[model samples]
Target: METIQREMTVFARRARASAGRMHPELSLVSYTLLGHLEERGGCRATDLAAHYALDKSTVSRQVAALERTGLIERLLDPEDHRVQVLQLTDAGRQLLLQVTDSRRAAFKERLADWPEEDLRRFADYLTRYNGWTPPAAG
Candidate 1:
């Protein structure tokens, strides 16, 4: 268990570091938020916060920074004109794609030597790990 925990921490640290190398302006959090927006076809700030279990203020700050960088914009929701949802700008989408491609290439290179069975097992383990939920607070 200790080994698993330590390795998971290492994995997270490496992911954060690699994110910086991929794009100076896009931190891991920023990249993740942008990816979520793209995947969800845009969503409210509160939705983002809830999905990530992040503080609303934190999400607000990140959103502001992305807007300042012209990477994201707010659009009125079609279903609710009074409400606004966050969406990536064209620049954001392009940058996201570039970083994604770079990350994918890097992964391919890094795992090129791994056996196919090992890769499949590793992938399944990751999926199972991510699917785990903590017990409710006492």
Candidate 2:
């Protein structure tokens, strides 16, 4: 368990470092938020905070930054005129696509030497690990 924890920490650090290399302007957190927005077809900032288990203030700050950079914009929700949801701008979509391609290429290059079976097992383990949720605290 300790070995797994240590390795996971190392993996997270490597991912963070690679995120900077992939796009100097996009932090890992920002990239993650943008990806979520893209995947969900836009959502409220509150939803983002709740989904990611992040503080609302943190999500607000990120949303403000993205808005200032023209990467995301707020639109009135069709179902609820009182509410606004964040969506990626055209520029954001393009930038995300570019960064994603870069990351994918990097992964492919790094894993090129790994055997197919090992890759499959690694993928499965990652999926299972990500699916886990800790039990609620008493």
Candidate 3:
């Protein structure tokens, strides 16, 4: 377990570093938040914080940065004029698509020589590991 933990930590660090290089202005966290917004159409800032298990302030900062970059915007919820939701702008969608393609291409190049079976097993293992749920908090 310790070995797995250590290796996973290293992998995560490297992935983040690679992502940073792919887009200097976008942190992995921000990219992830953007992806979530893209996927969900629109959501509240509080929703992002809760979904990512992040502090509201931290999410707020990221949202603010994204807003400044013109990647995201706040819109009034049609059903509830009092509420606001975040959504990606056209520019944000385009940027995310480009970055995603670049990342996928990089992954393909890095693993080009690996056999399909190995790749399948690796992906399955990652999914299994990620799917594990911790015991409920007391």
- Encode model 2's per-residue lDDT on 76-138: one tens digit a residue: 999999999999999999999999999999999999999999999999999999989989999
In candidate 1, position 99 carries an lDDT of 93
TM-score of 2: 0.95
Please write out the lDDT profile of model 1 over residues 1-105, one tens digit for every residue.
Answer: 999999999999999999999998899999999999999989999999999989999999999999999999999999999999999999999998999999999
TM-score of each: 0.95, 0.95, 0.94
Each model's lDDT: 0.96, 0.96, 0.95
Off by over 4 Å in 2: none
Error of 2 at 90 (Å): 0.3
Query: Against the true structure, what is every candidate's RMSD?
Result: 1.1, 1.1, 1.2
Q: Residue 34 in model 2: shift from native, Å?
A: 0.8
Q: Which residue pairs come into collision in candidate 2?
A: none
